[model samples]
Target: MENILIPLMDNELSPRFDLAPEVLIISITRETSAMGTLSERVINFETPSAEAMYRLVMAENIQTIICAGMEKEVYEFLKRKGIKVLDNVCGPVDPILEAYLAGHLSSGQNYF
Candidate 1:
């Protein structure tokens, strides 16, 4: 079982991390092959802080993050907590999640 988080801009991925106005979360299980939606939340920030986002990820028990252009400090912090951050992923939210479910999502790449 794993929970994945994406910083979203409309239905597409945000162009950059730490600047997304909203977020989408998915809950997935290896045995069941379903992309279950856990929640979607607005990032409450005039300027979204990486630290604030990290706290939300931790609180949500997010195992993986599919996002674009994350800062090194934030990336390292998530890794230190054993969370997988797939940075630089670009495209529509649905296809990206689908690619992940099919096991081919990657950082700095488009897998659709």
Candidate 2:
């Protein structure tokens, strides 16, 4: 099982990681099929804060993060903590999540 987090803005991938208003977390079991067995959760932030997001990532045990843009420092921080950060991803959240589950998503991928 893998826990993935995606920051969101208006139903699409956020333009910048630290500025996102909300996030979607999906816990996926890859043992099933391409779609896998997914359990999802959405978290809305009262205020956008990188610290808050980082705390949530740790608390939720997030294994991967799919984001549009991220600062180098933040990227390095997550990497050092053993998290996979797929940066520069663009498009609607649903399709992006589907591509990830289907094993076709990667950093710098754009659907729009």
Candidate 3:
């Protein structure tokens, strides 16, 4: 099973699903690895550093993460730990992520 952690901003939702900042929604499935789907959503407390982020993933056992941006320190930390970081994403996360899951979006080489 593959797990995806997505960091989201508050305004992305149009009042219906108001969420807090520095929170991540996790998605997963039994088949096809639905990392960003709505089946599962896990909210985090803070935006951790690279090393701390790796530790969080280890604690949660997550494999991937989707976010708008990240610090270089965190990037290298996750890379060394073999955790895939998908950064530089735009708002209204659900759509962008859906596209990614559908094979339309690429994480790009900037993260590596």
Q: What are the models' TM-scores?
A: 0.81, 0.93, 0.67
At residue 75, give the lDDT of candidate 3: 71
Model 3: pairs clashing at backbone N, Cα or C within 3 Å: 50-74
Please give the lDDT score at residue 55 for candidate 1. Answer: 75
Candidates by lDDT, descending order: 2, 1, 3
Query: Which predicted model would earn the best TM-score?
Result: 2
Error of 2 at 95 (Å): 1.3
lDDT of 1 by residue, 1-112 (tens): 6778889887888877778877887776555455443444444456666766777898889998999888888788889999988998888988887787778888878744
Record all residue pairs in model 2 with backbone atoms less than 3 Å apart, i.e. clashing: none
**Candidate 2 local lDDT, residue 91:** 95
Clashing pairs in 1: none
Worst 10 residues of 2 by lDDT: 29-38
lDDT by residue for model 3 (1-112), tens: 5677665556242111112344465555554454332456646545334445455567877788766666677678777888777666556766765676676765531221
lDDT of each: 0.78, 0.92, 0.57
For each candidate in turn, give its C-alpha RMSD to the true structure in angstroms. 2.9, 1.4, 6.6
lDDT of 2 by residue, 1-112 (tens): 8999999999999998888999999998877464467899889999998999999999999999999999999999999999999999999998998888777899999999
